[model samples]
Target: MFSGNGHGKLVGSTQVDELGVLESPVVLTATLSVFRAADALLSWLMERRPDGVSFNPLVGETNDGHLSDIRRRPITEDHVLAAVAQASDGPPAEGCVGAGAGTTALGFKAGIGTSSRTVRTAGRTGTVGALVQSNFGGVLTVLGVPMPADELVPAADRTEPPGNSCMIVVATDLPVDARQLGRLARRAVFAMARVGASFSSTSGDYAIAFTTSDQPPIPDGEIDPVFAAVLDAVEEALLNSLFTAVTTTGVGGRTSHAVPHRAVIERLTAAGRLPAPPLIPESPSETRLRTTPARDEPGS
Candidate 1:
Protein backbone atom coordinates (compact mmCIF):
# COMPACT_ATOMS: atom_id res chain seq x y z
CA MET A 1 0.00 0.00 0.00
CA PHE A 2 0.96 3.66 -0.45
CA SER A 3 0.06 6.66 1.70
CA GLY A 4 0.68 10.38 2.48
CA ASN A 5 0.21 12.99 5.20
CA GLY A 6 -0.01 16.76 4.85
CA HIS A 7 -0.02 19.68 7.28
CA GLY A 8 -1.44 17.93 10.33
CA LYS A 9 0.55 16.28 13.10
CA LEU A 10 0.59 13.15 10.98
CA VAL A 11 2.54 10.36 12.68
CA GLY A 12 4.58 8.04 10.50
CA SER A 13 4.61 10.43 7.59
CA THR A 14 8.39 10.47 7.30
CA GLN A 15 8.52 6.69 7.08
CA VAL A 16 5.97 6.54 4.28
CA ASP A 17 7.88 9.21 2.44
CA GLU A 18 11.19 7.45 2.76
CA LEU A 19 9.97 3.96 1.88
CA GLY A 20 6.98 4.75 -0.32
CA VAL A 21 5.00 1.96 1.34
CA LEU A 22 2.45 1.64 4.07
CA GLU A 23 2.97 -1.29 6.46
CA SER A 24 0.04 -0.88 8.76
CA PRO A 25 -3.58 0.16 8.99
CA VAL A 26 -4.16 3.91 8.76
CA VAL A 27 -5.98 5.14 11.81
CA LEU A 28 -7.51 8.61 11.88
CA THR A 29 -8.23 10.36 15.15
CA ALA A 30 -8.12 13.68 16.92
CA THR A 31 -4.75 15.36 17.43
CA LEU A 32 -4.53 14.50 21.10
CA SER A 33 -5.04 10.78 20.54
CA VAL A 34 -2.39 10.27 17.89
CA PHE A 35 -0.13 8.30 20.19
CA ARG A 36 -2.84 6.07 21.63
CA ALA A 37 -4.16 5.43 18.13
CA ALA A 38 -0.69 4.59 16.89
CA ASP A 39 -0.05 2.25 19.80
CA ALA A 40 -3.30 0.48 19.15
CA LEU A 41 -2.50 0.10 15.48
CA LEU A 42 0.97 -1.20 16.26
CA SER A 43 -0.43 -3.69 18.74
CA TRP A 44 -2.92 -4.92 16.16
CA LEU A 45 -0.28 -5.24 13.46
CA MET A 46 2.07 -7.11 15.77
CA GLU A 47 -0.54 -9.83 16.23
CA ARG A 48 -0.45 -10.45 12.49
CA ARG A 49 3.22 -9.91 11.83
CA PRO A 50 4.85 -10.95 15.06
CA ASP A 51 8.35 -10.51 13.77
CA GLY A 52 7.85 -6.96 12.58
CA VAL A 53 9.57 -4.73 15.10
CA SER A 54 10.06 -1.65 12.95
CA PHE A 55 6.68 -1.39 11.32
CA ASN A 56 5.34 2.15 11.13
CA PRO A 57 1.81 2.56 12.34
CA LEU A 58 0.24 5.16 10.10
CA VAL A 59 -2.06 7.49 12.00
CA GLY A 60 -3.30 10.89 10.90
CA GLU A 61 -5.20 13.71 12.52
CA THR A 62 -6.77 17.20 12.31
CA ASN A 63 -7.41 19.47 15.24
CA ASP A 64 -10.97 18.99 16.54
CA GLY A 65 -10.56 20.85 19.81
CA HIS A 66 -13.33 23.31 19.10
CA LEU A 67 -15.99 20.63 18.70
CA SER A 68 -14.42 17.73 20.60
CA ASP A 69 -13.06 17.38 24.11
CA ILE A 70 -9.67 16.65 22.64
CA ARG A 71 -7.77 17.17 25.85
CA ARG A 72 -9.57 14.13 27.23
CA ARG A 73 -8.03 11.97 24.51
CA PRO A 74 -11.14 9.85 24.31
CA ILE A 75 -9.84 7.49 21.65
CA THR A 76 -8.48 4.31 23.17
CA GLU A 77 -7.01 1.00 22.08
CA ASP A 78 -10.42 -0.64 22.19
CA HIS A 79 -11.92 1.98 19.92
CA VAL A 80 -9.04 1.58 17.51
CA LEU A 81 -9.25 -2.22 17.46
CA ALA A 82 -13.02 -2.12 17.13
CA ALA A 83 -12.70 0.02 14.03
CA VAL A 84 -10.15 -2.30 12.47
CA ALA A 85 -12.12 -5.40 13.34
CA GLN A 86 -15.37 -4.18 11.80
CA ALA A 87 -13.94 -2.90 8.52
CA SER A 88 -16.11 -3.88 5.53
CA ASP A 89 -16.93 -3.02 1.95
CA GLY A 90 -20.51 -2.07 2.61
CA PRO A 91 -21.50 1.60 2.35
CA PRO A 92 -19.39 3.70 4.71
CA ALA A 93 -20.82 5.94 7.41
CA GLU A 94 -20.16 9.59 6.52
CA GLY A 95 -20.46 13.00 8.18
CA CYS A 96 -19.72 13.20 11.90
CA VAL A 97 -18.21 9.85 12.72
CA GLY A 98 -14.77 8.60 13.72
CA ALA A 99 -12.11 11.18 12.94
CA GLY A 100 -14.76 13.32 11.32
CA ALA A 101 -17.01 13.22 14.33
CA GLY A 102 -16.06 16.75 15.30
CA THR A 103 -14.92 18.31 12.04
CA THR A 104 -16.09 21.42 10.17
CA ALA A 105 -15.58 22.44 6.58
CA LEU A 106 -16.04 25.72 4.74
CA GLY A 107 -17.83 27.07 7.80
CA PHE A 108 -20.31 24.18 7.90
CA LYS A 109 -20.77 21.07 9.99
CA ALA A 110 -18.72 18.89 7.69
CA GLY A 111 -17.41 15.41 8.40
CA ILE A 112 -16.63 12.28 6.44
CA GLY A 113 -17.60 12.27 2.77
CA THR A 114 -16.72 9.77 0.04
CA SER A 115 -17.15 9.38 -3.74
CA SER A 116 -15.75 7.24 -6.55
CA ARG A 117 -15.37 7.34 -10.31
CA THR A 118 -14.75 4.70 -12.95
CA VAL A 119 -12.12 5.40 -15.62
CA ARG A 120 -11.31 3.42 -18.74
CA THR A 121 -7.84 3.48 -20.25
CA ALA A 122 -6.05 1.18 -22.65
CA GLY A 123 -9.11 -1.12 -22.80
CA ARG A 124 -9.11 -1.52 -19.02
CA THR A 125 -11.53 -0.02 -16.54
CA GLY A 126 -10.51 1.09 -13.06
CA THR A 127 -12.24 2.71 -10.14
CA VAL A 128 -10.93 5.61 -8.07
CA GLY A 129 -12.55 6.28 -4.71
CA ALA A 130 -12.03 9.27 -2.40
CA LEU A 131 -12.87 9.46 1.28
CA VAL A 132 -12.32 12.83 2.92
CA GLN A 133 -12.42 14.00 6.49
CA SER A 134 -13.75 17.45 5.69
CA ASN A 135 -12.40 19.59 8.51
CA PHE A 136 -10.95 22.56 6.66
CA GLY A 137 -11.96 26.17 5.96
CA GLY A 138 -12.60 27.96 2.68
CA VAL A 139 -15.29 29.51 0.55
CA LEU A 140 -17.79 26.73 -0.17
CA THR A 141 -18.45 25.86 -3.78
CA VAL A 142 -20.57 23.18 -5.34
CA LEU A 143 -19.89 22.14 -8.90
CA GLY A 144 -17.73 25.20 -9.59
CA VAL A 145 -20.41 27.68 -8.39
CA PRO A 146 -19.36 29.66 -5.32
CA MET A 147 -21.72 30.05 -2.40
CA PRO A 148 -22.08 33.43 -0.77
CA ALA A 149 -20.70 32.50 2.63
CA ASP A 150 -21.56 35.74 4.35
CA GLU A 151 -25.16 35.64 3.20
CA LEU A 152 -25.65 31.92 3.76
CA VAL A 153 -23.78 31.68 7.04
CA PRO A 154 -23.98 34.70 9.24
CA ALA A 155 -21.00 35.52 11.45
CA ALA A 156 -22.72 34.23 14.57
CA ASP A 157 -23.38 30.76 13.10
CA ARG A 158 -19.96 30.34 11.53
CA THR A 159 -17.78 28.07 13.70
CA GLU A 160 -14.69 27.41 11.64
CA PRO A 161 -12.16 26.05 14.09
CA PRO A 162 -8.52 27.12 14.05
CA GLY A 163 -5.81 24.99 12.39
CA ASN A 164 -8.04 23.89 9.51
CA SER A 165 -7.21 20.52 8.00
CA CYS A 166 -8.52 17.92 5.54
CA MET A 167 -7.47 14.32 5.09
CA ILE A 168 -8.16 12.75 1.69
CA VAL A 169 -7.66 9.01 1.21
CA VAL A 170 -7.88 7.69 -2.32
CA ALA A 171 -8.16 4.03 -3.27
CA THR A 172 -7.96 2.74 -6.81
CA ASP A 173 -7.99 -0.57 -8.64
CA LEU A 174 -5.42 0.45 -11.23
CA PRO A 175 -1.77 -0.59 -11.12
CA VAL A 176 0.35 2.42 -10.26
CA ASP A 177 3.64 2.78 -8.43
CA ALA A 178 4.57 5.21 -5.69
CA ARG A 179 5.59 7.95 -8.14
CA GLN A 180 2.34 7.76 -10.07
CA LEU A 181 0.35 7.55 -6.85
CA GLY A 182 2.09 10.71 -5.62
CA ARG A 183 1.02 12.47 -8.80
CA LEU A 184 -2.54 11.30 -8.25
CA ALA A 185 -2.45 12.61 -4.68
CA ARG A 186 -1.40 16.04 -5.93
CA ARG A 187 -4.38 16.10 -8.24
CA ALA A 188 -6.63 15.55 -5.25
CA VAL A 189 -5.34 18.87 -3.90
CA PHE A 190 -6.39 20.45 -7.15
CA ALA A 191 -9.84 18.99 -6.55
CA MET A 192 -9.90 20.70 -3.17
CA ALA A 193 -9.05 23.99 -4.82
CA ARG A 194 -11.92 23.54 -7.24
CA VAL A 195 -14.29 23.26 -4.30
CA GLY A 196 -12.96 26.66 -3.12
CA ALA A 197 -10.20 25.68 -0.70
CA SER A 198 -7.32 28.16 -0.75
CA PHE A 199 -4.78 25.58 0.55
CA SER A 200 -4.15 28.12 3.25
CA SER A 201 -0.77 28.15 4.98
CA THR A 202 -2.10 26.04 7.84
CA SER A 203 -5.09 24.16 6.41
CA GLY A 204 -2.96 21.02 6.05
CA ASP A 205 -4.78 19.45 3.08
CA TYR A 206 -3.40 15.95 2.48
CA ALA A 207 -4.24 13.05 0.13
CA ILE A 208 -3.15 9.40 0.15
CA ALA A 209 -3.84 7.25 -2.92
CA PHE A 210 -3.03 3.58 -3.50
CA THR A 211 -3.78 1.03 -6.18
CA THR A 212 -5.01 -2.55 -5.65
CA SER A 213 -4.09 -3.94 -9.04
CA ASP A 214 -0.87 -5.91 -9.58
CA GLN A 215 -0.45 -5.16 -13.28
CA PRO A 216 2.57 -3.16 -14.38
CA PRO A 217 2.20 0.55 -13.92
CA ILE A 218 0.50 2.40 -16.74
CA PRO A 219 2.85 4.82 -18.48
CA ASP A 220 2.80 8.46 -17.44
CA GLY A 221 1.09 9.52 -20.66
CA GLU A 222 -1.91 7.24 -19.95
CA ILE A 223 -2.51 8.64 -16.44
CA ASP A 224 -4.62 11.62 -17.45
CA PRO A 225 -7.87 9.69 -17.12
CA VAL A 226 -6.98 8.64 -13.58
CA PHE A 227 -6.06 12.21 -12.66
CA ALA A 228 -9.34 13.55 -14.02
CA ALA A 229 -11.29 10.92 -12.15
CA VAL A 230 -9.52 11.77 -8.89
CA LEU A 231 -10.31 15.44 -9.36
CA ASP A 232 -14.00 14.82 -10.00
CA ALA A 233 -14.36 12.31 -7.20
CA VAL A 234 -12.62 14.47 -4.59
CA GLU A 235 -14.71 17.53 -5.47
CA GLU A 236 -17.98 15.62 -5.30
CA ALA A 237 -16.94 13.94 -2.09
CA LEU A 238 -16.25 17.26 -0.36
CA LEU A 239 -19.63 18.57 -1.43
CA ASN A 240 -21.26 15.37 -0.23
CA SER A 241 -19.71 15.81 3.21
CA LEU A 242 -21.33 19.19 3.57
CA PHE A 243 -24.63 18.08 2.10
CA THR A 244 -25.00 15.03 4.33
CA ALA A 245 -23.97 16.66 7.60
CA VAL A 246 -26.48 17.81 10.20
CA THR A 247 -26.05 20.82 12.41
CA THR A 248 -24.03 19.77 15.44
CA THR A 249 -23.20 21.28 18.85
CA GLY A 250 -20.03 20.18 20.57
CA VAL A 251 -17.35 21.30 23.04
CA GLY A 252 -17.93 24.67 24.72
CA GLY A 253 -21.47 24.56 23.24
CA ARG A 254 -20.12 25.73 19.88
CA THR A 255 -22.32 24.73 16.98
CA SER A 256 -21.74 24.02 13.30
CA HIS A 257 -24.64 23.84 10.90
CA ALA A 258 -25.21 21.76 7.83
CA VAL A 259 -25.69 23.39 4.46
CA PRO A 260 -29.26 23.54 3.21
CA HIS A 261 -29.81 20.89 0.55
CA ARG A 262 -33.03 22.10 -1.03
CA ALA A 263 -31.61 25.59 -1.44
CA VAL A 264 -28.50 24.27 -3.15
CA ILE A 265 -30.54 22.14 -5.54
CA GLU A 266 -32.72 25.08 -6.37
CA ARG A 267 -29.72 27.27 -7.04
CA LEU A 268 -28.11 24.67 -9.25
CA THR A 269 -31.34 24.14 -11.13
CA ALA A 270 -31.77 27.87 -11.62
CA ALA A 271 -28.22 28.08 -12.89
CA GLY A 272 -28.95 25.34 -15.43
CA ARG A 273 -26.28 23.13 -13.94
CA LEU A 274 -28.25 20.09 -12.93
CA PRO A 275 -28.04 17.20 -15.35
CA ALA A 276 -31.07 15.96 -17.25
CA PRO A 277 -33.10 13.28 -15.51
CA PRO A 278 -32.85 9.73 -16.75
CA LEU A 279 -35.42 8.69 -19.37
CA ILE A 280 -37.53 5.60 -18.89
CA PRO A 281 -37.61 2.89 -21.58
CA GLU A 282 -40.86 2.31 -23.41
CA SER A 283 -42.23 -1.16 -24.13
CA PRO A 284 -42.31 -2.49 -27.71
CA SER A 285 -45.67 -2.51 -29.51
CA GLU A 286 -47.36 -5.89 -29.99
CA THR A 287 -48.05 -4.98 -33.65
CA ARG A 288 -44.35 -4.72 -34.44
CA LEU A 289 -43.72 -7.02 -37.50
CA ARG A 290 -40.65 -8.68 -35.95
CA THR A 291 -42.58 -9.79 -32.85
CA THR A 292 -45.99 -10.55 -34.48
CA PRO A 293 -46.90 -13.99 -35.82
CA ALA A 294 -47.55 -14.15 -39.58
CA ARG A 295 -50.74 -15.70 -40.97
CA ASP A 296 -50.46 -19.50 -41.48
CA GLU A 297 -49.19 -18.88 -45.00
CA PRO A 298 -46.30 -21.11 -45.98
CA GLY A 299 -46.86 -23.78 -43.29
CA SER A 300 -50.18 -24.85 -44.78
Candidate 2:
Protein backbone atom coordinates (compact mmCIF):
# COMPACT_ATOMS: atom_id res chain seq x y z
CA MET A 1 0.00 0.00 0.00
CA PHE A 2 2.73 2.42 0.98
CA SER A 3 6.53 2.34 1.22
CA GLY A 4 9.70 4.14 2.37
CA ASN A 5 13.42 4.06 1.56
CA GLY A 6 16.46 4.25 3.86
CA HIS A 7 19.58 4.54 1.62
CA GLY A 8 20.51 2.67 -1.56
CA LYS A 9 19.89 2.43 -5.28
CA LEU A 10 16.09 2.43 -5.50
CA VAL A 11 14.54 2.97 -8.92
CA GLY A 12 11.09 4.59 -8.90
CA SER A 13 11.44 5.68 -5.27
CA THR A 14 10.44 9.25 -6.08
CA GLN A 15 7.04 8.15 -7.35
CA VAL A 16 6.35 6.11 -4.22
CA ASP A 17 7.08 9.17 -2.08
CA GLU A 18 5.26 11.63 -4.31
CA LEU A 19 2.10 9.51 -4.56
CA GLY A 20 2.27 7.81 -1.14
CA VAL A 21 1.57 4.47 -2.84
CA LEU A 22 3.36 1.72 -4.73
CA GLU A 23 1.49 1.37 -8.03
CA SER A 24 3.68 -1.39 -9.43
CA PRO A 25 5.54 -4.56 -8.55
CA VAL A 26 8.85 -4.36 -6.64
CA VAL A 27 11.82 -6.26 -8.03
CA LEU A 28 15.21 -6.77 -6.38
CA THR A 29 18.38 -7.56 -8.34
CA ALA A 30 22.07 -6.96 -8.88
CA THR A 31 22.92 -3.24 -9.11
CA LEU A 32 23.78 -3.29 -12.79
CA SER A 33 20.69 -5.31 -13.66
CA VAL A 34 18.14 -3.01 -12.03
CA PHE A 35 17.29 -1.07 -15.15
CA ARG A 36 16.77 -4.22 -17.22
CA ALA A 37 14.41 -5.59 -14.59
CA ALA A 38 12.51 -2.32 -14.50
CA ASP A 39 12.23 -2.20 -18.26
CA ALA A 40 10.91 -5.74 -18.35
CA LEU A 41 8.43 -4.97 -15.55
CA LEU A 42 7.27 -1.81 -17.28
CA SER A 43 6.62 -3.71 -20.48
CA TRP A 44 4.72 -6.38 -18.60
CA LEU A 45 2.65 -3.77 -16.79
CA MET A 46 1.94 -1.89 -19.96
CA GLU A 47 0.33 -4.96 -21.50
CA ARG A 48 -1.76 -5.45 -18.36
CA ARG A 49 -2.78 -1.80 -18.18
CA PRO A 50 -3.55 -1.05 -21.79
CA ASP A 51 -5.13 2.29 -20.90
CA GLY A 52 -2.25 3.39 -18.71
CA VAL A 53 0.17 5.94 -20.08
CA SER A 54 2.77 6.04 -17.30
CA PHE A 55 3.77 3.85 -14.32
CA ASN A 56 6.60 3.57 -11.84
CA PRO A 57 8.18 0.14 -11.45
CA LEU A 58 10.00 -0.16 -8.15
CA VAL A 59 13.37 -1.91 -8.40
CA GLY A 60 16.11 -2.16 -5.79
CA GLU A 61 19.70 -3.38 -6.04
CA THR A 62 23.04 -4.17 -4.39
CA ASN A 63 26.36 -4.76 -6.14
CA ASP A 64 27.41 -8.38 -6.64
CA GLY A 65 30.67 -7.77 -8.50
CA HIS A 66 32.86 -9.47 -5.93
CA LEU A 67 31.31 -12.81 -6.81
CA SER A 68 29.75 -12.27 -10.19
CA ASP A 69 30.77 -10.84 -13.53
CA ILE A 70 28.64 -7.77 -13.03
CA ARG A 71 30.18 -6.05 -16.01
CA ARG A 72 28.70 -8.75 -18.22
CA ARG A 73 25.23 -7.43 -17.35
CA PRO A 74 23.69 -10.87 -17.77
CA ILE A 75 20.15 -10.24 -16.49
CA THR A 76 17.54 -10.05 -19.21
CA GLU A 77 13.87 -9.12 -19.73
CA ASP A 78 13.03 -12.78 -20.26
CA HIS A 79 14.57 -13.59 -16.94
CA VAL A 80 12.45 -10.94 -15.29
CA LEU A 81 9.30 -12.20 -17.04
CA ALA A 82 10.08 -15.76 -15.98
CA ALA A 83 10.44 -14.70 -12.35
CA VAL A 84 7.12 -12.89 -12.47
CA ALA A 85 5.46 -15.89 -14.05
CA GLN A 86 6.93 -18.35 -11.59
CA ALA A 87 5.89 -16.44 -8.47
CA SER A 88 4.03 -18.51 -5.91
CA ASP A 89 2.70 -18.20 -2.37
CA GLY A 90 4.90 -20.16 -0.03
CA PRO A 91 8.14 -19.90 1.93
CA PRO A 92 10.79 -18.37 -0.33
CA ALA A 93 14.12 -20.04 -1.03
CA GLU A 94 16.88 -18.21 0.86
CA GLY A 95 20.72 -18.16 0.97
CA CYS A 96 22.35 -17.75 -2.42
CA VAL A 97 19.42 -17.55 -4.77
CA GLY A 98 17.94 -14.96 -7.08
CA ALA A 99 19.45 -11.53 -6.51
CA GLY A 100 21.56 -12.87 -3.64
CA ALA A 101 23.36 -15.50 -5.68
CA GLY A 102 26.70 -13.69 -5.71
CA THR A 103 26.65 -11.64 -2.52
CA THR A 104 29.10 -11.77 0.39
CA ALA A 105 28.74 -10.28 3.83
CA LEU A 106 30.88 -9.83 6.96
CA GLY A 107 33.69 -11.70 5.23
CA PHE A 108 31.45 -14.65 4.46
CA LYS A 109 29.16 -15.85 1.74
CA ALA A 110 25.80 -14.13 2.33
CA GLY A 111 22.57 -13.91 0.40
CA ILE A 112 18.82 -13.66 0.76
CA GLY A 113 17.61 -14.10 4.35
CA THR A 114 14.15 -13.56 5.82
CA SER A 115 12.42 -13.38 9.24
CA SER A 116 9.17 -12.18 10.76
CA ARG A 117 7.66 -11.10 14.09
CA THR A 118 4.11 -10.80 15.35
CA VAL A 119 3.13 -7.69 17.32
CA ARG A 120 -0.06 -6.33 18.79
CA THR A 121 -1.23 -2.73 18.79
CA ALA A 122 -4.66 -1.59 19.96
CA GLY A 123 -5.54 -5.24 20.50
CA ARG A 124 -4.93 -6.06 16.84
CA THR A 125 -2.18 -8.44 15.88
CA GLY A 126 -0.08 -8.08 12.73
CA THR A 127 3.12 -9.56 11.38
CA VAL A 128 6.24 -7.73 10.28
CA GLY A 129 8.45 -9.62 7.82
CA ALA A 130 11.95 -8.73 6.67
CA LEU A 131 14.06 -9.92 3.72
CA VAL A 132 17.65 -8.78 3.34
CA GLN A 133 20.33 -8.91 0.67
CA SER A 134 23.25 -8.77 3.09
CA ASN A 135 26.48 -7.81 1.36
CA PHE A 136 28.12 -5.53 3.91
CA GLY A 137 31.08 -5.61 6.33
CA GLY A 138 31.42 -5.45 10.11
CA VAL A 139 32.52 -7.56 13.07
CA LEU A 140 29.93 -10.33 13.06
CA THR A 141 27.96 -10.44 16.34
CA VAL A 142 25.02 -12.63 17.21
CA LEU A 143 22.69 -12.24 20.21
CA GLY A 144 25.10 -9.79 21.89
CA VAL A 145 27.90 -12.34 21.71
CA PRO A 146 31.06 -11.45 19.84
CA MET A 147 32.20 -13.90 17.16
CA PRO A 148 35.88 -13.24 16.71
CA ALA A 149 36.96 -12.75 13.10
CA ASP A 150 39.67 -15.42 13.38
CA GLU A 151 37.15 -18.18 14.17
CA LEU A 152 35.37 -17.88 10.85
CA VAL A 153 36.30 -19.94 7.81
CA PRO A 154 38.90 -18.02 5.82
CA ALA A 155 38.06 -16.39 2.52
CA ALA A 156 40.44 -16.19 -0.38
CA ASP A 157 43.01 -13.41 0.15
CA ARG A 158 41.71 -10.22 -1.40
CA THR A 159 42.93 -6.69 -1.86
CA GLU A 160 39.83 -5.17 -0.29
CA PRO A 161 37.55 -6.28 2.57
CA PRO A 162 34.51 -8.22 1.42
CA GLY A 163 31.44 -5.96 1.45
CA ASN A 164 29.64 -3.58 -0.86
CA SER A 165 26.00 -2.93 0.02
CA CYS A 166 22.86 -4.25 1.69
CA MET A 167 19.25 -4.05 0.62
CA ILE A 168 16.51 -4.65 3.19
CA VAL A 169 12.80 -4.99 2.52
CA VAL A 170 10.25 -4.87 5.33
CA ALA A 171 6.63 -5.84 4.83
CA THR A 172 3.90 -5.56 7.46
CA ASP A 173 0.18 -6.05 7.67
CA LEU A 174 -0.21 -3.12 10.03
CA PRO A 175 -2.14 -0.04 8.94
CA VAL A 176 0.47 2.67 8.47
CA ASP A 177 1.05 5.57 6.12
CA ALA A 178 4.05 6.33 3.93
CA ARG A 179 5.54 8.59 6.62
CA GLN A 180 5.15 5.91 9.28
CA LEU A 181 6.49 3.29 6.88
CA GLY A 182 9.56 5.48 6.41
CA ARG A 183 10.17 5.33 10.14
CA LEU A 184 9.85 1.55 10.05
CA ALA A 185 12.36 1.41 7.19
CA ARG A 186 14.81 3.40 9.29
CA ARG A 187 14.59 0.86 12.09
CA ALA A 188 15.38 -1.96 9.68
CA VAL A 189 18.59 -0.16 8.71
CA PHE A 190 19.43 0.46 12.36
CA ALA A 191 19.27 -3.30 12.95
CA MET A 192 22.12 -3.62 10.44
CA ALA A 193 24.45 -2.01 12.97
CA ARG A 194 23.56 -4.71 15.51
CA VAL A 195 24.91 -7.36 13.12
CA GLY A 196 28.13 -5.36 12.50
CA ALA A 197 27.35 -3.46 9.30
CA SER A 198 29.80 -0.56 8.99
CA PHE A 199 27.52 1.44 6.68
CA SER A 200 30.74 2.30 4.94
CA SER A 201 30.98 5.26 2.59
CA THR A 202 31.20 2.96 -0.41
CA SER A 203 28.47 0.67 0.89
CA GLY A 204 24.87 1.25 -0.08
CA ASP A 205 22.65 0.36 2.88
CA TYR A 206 18.98 0.81 2.16
CA ALA A 207 15.63 -0.39 3.47
CA ILE A 208 12.14 -0.28 1.99
CA ALA A 209 9.19 -0.70 4.35
CA PHE A 210 5.62 -1.21 3.21
CA THR A 211 2.21 -2.27 4.47
CA THR A 212 -0.12 -4.76 2.73
CA SER A 213 -3.51 -4.17 4.27
CA ASP A 214 -6.45 -1.77 4.10
CA GLN A 215 -6.98 -1.42 7.83
CA PRO A 216 -7.24 1.99 9.46
CA PRO A 217 -3.95 3.79 10.02
CA ILE A 218 -2.37 3.18 13.41
CA PRO A 219 -2.12 6.24 15.61
CA ASP A 220 1.35 7.74 15.99
CA GLY A 221 1.23 7.27 19.77
CA GLU A 222 0.79 3.49 19.36
CA ILE A 223 3.66 2.78 16.98
CA ASP A 224 6.40 1.72 19.40
CA PRO A 225 5.50 -1.97 19.32
CA VAL A 226 5.68 -1.88 15.56
CA PHE A 227 9.11 -0.31 15.72
CA ALA A 228 10.35 -2.97 18.13
CA ALA A 229 9.03 -5.71 15.86
CA VAL A 230 10.81 -4.22 12.87
CA LEU A 231 14.09 -4.02 14.75
CA ASP A 232 13.90 -7.61 15.99
CA ALA A 233 12.84 -9.01 12.62
CA VAL A 234 15.52 -7.19 10.67
CA GLU A 235 18.27 -8.24 13.04
CA GLU A 236 17.19 -11.87 12.87
CA ALA A 237 16.94 -11.71 9.11
CA LEU A 238 20.53 -10.56 8.75
CA LEU A 239 21.76 -13.29 11.09
CA ASN A 240 19.84 -15.87 9.14
CA SER A 241 21.61 -14.66 6.01
CA LEU A 242 24.94 -15.51 7.57
CA PHE A 243 23.87 -18.77 9.14
CA THR A 244 22.25 -20.31 6.09
CA ALA A 245 24.72 -19.21 3.45
CA VAL A 246 27.26 -21.86 2.47
CA THR A 247 30.79 -21.48 1.08
CA THR A 248 30.72 -20.24 -2.48
CA THR A 249 33.23 -19.87 -5.31
CA GLY A 250 32.36 -17.07 -7.64
CA VAL A 251 33.77 -14.91 -10.42
CA GLY A 252 37.53 -15.05 -11.00
CA GLY A 253 37.77 -18.15 -8.79
CA ARG A 254 37.24 -15.98 -5.70
CA THR A 255 35.78 -17.89 -2.78
CA SER A 256 33.75 -16.69 0.19
CA HIS A 257 33.37 -19.02 3.15
CA ALA A 258 30.26 -19.72 5.15
CA VAL A 259 29.84 -18.94 8.85
CA PRO A 260 30.52 -21.78 11.25
CA HIS A 261 27.10 -22.53 12.76
CA ARG A 262 28.34 -25.03 15.35
CA ALA A 263 30.82 -22.53 16.70
CA VAL A 264 28.13 -19.89 17.09
CA ILE A 265 25.79 -22.34 18.80
CA GLU A 266 28.50 -23.43 21.17
CA ARG A 267 29.41 -19.85 22.04
CA LEU A 268 25.82 -18.81 22.58
CA THR A 269 25.06 -21.85 24.69
CA ALA A 270 28.15 -21.31 26.83
CA ALA A 271 27.13 -17.71 27.34
CA GLY A 272 23.69 -18.84 28.61
CA ARG A 273 22.04 -16.95 25.78
CA LEU A 274 20.43 -19.82 23.93
CA PRO A 275 16.77 -20.54 24.62
CA ALA A 276 15.41 -23.97 25.43
CA PRO A 277 14.80 -26.25 22.48
CA PRO A 278 11.28 -26.19 21.06
CA LEU A 279 8.91 -29.11 21.46
CA ILE A 280 8.64 -31.52 18.60
CA PRO A 281 5.62 -30.84 16.45
CA GLU A 282 2.74 -33.31 16.80
CA SER A 283 1.66 -35.54 13.95
CA PRO A 284 -1.74 -35.12 12.33
CA SER A 285 -3.18 -38.32 13.91
CA GLU A 286 -1.75 -37.34 17.28
CA THR A 287 -3.59 -34.05 17.10
CA ARG A 288 -7.01 -35.82 17.21
CA LEU A 289 -8.86 -35.44 20.51
CA ARG A 290 -10.45 -38.28 22.45
CA THR A 291 -14.01 -37.90 23.74
CA THR A 292 -12.97 -38.43 27.37
CA PRO A 293 -9.96 -37.36 29.43
CA ALA A 294 -7.44 -40.08 30.26
CA ARG A 295 -8.15 -39.92 34.00
CA ASP A 296 -11.95 -40.11 33.45
CA GLU A 297 -11.88 -42.86 30.84
CA PRO A 298 -13.24 -46.36 31.62
CA GLY A 299 -9.81 -47.87 30.85
CA SER A 300 -8.25 -45.67 33.48
Alpha-carbon lDDT, every model: 0.75, 0.77
Residues 128-207 of candidate 2 have per-residue lDDT tens digits of: 99999888877788888877555644434343354578888899998998889988988998898888877776777878
Poorest stretch of ten by lDDT in candidate 1? 284-293
The C-alpha stretches of model 2 lying farther than 4 A from their native spots are: 1-8, 154-163, 275-300
| Top candidate when judged by TM-score against the true structure | 1
**Candidate 2 deviates by what RMSD?**
12.9
lDDT, model 2: 0.77
Which one is best on lDDT? 2
What are the per-residue Cα lDDT tens digits for candidate 1 across 114-176? 999999986689899999888877788887677755656565365465448888888899988
Task: Compute each candidate's TM-score over C-alphas.
Answer: 0.87, 0.86
Q: For each candidate, C-alpha RMSD in Å? A: 15.6, 12.9
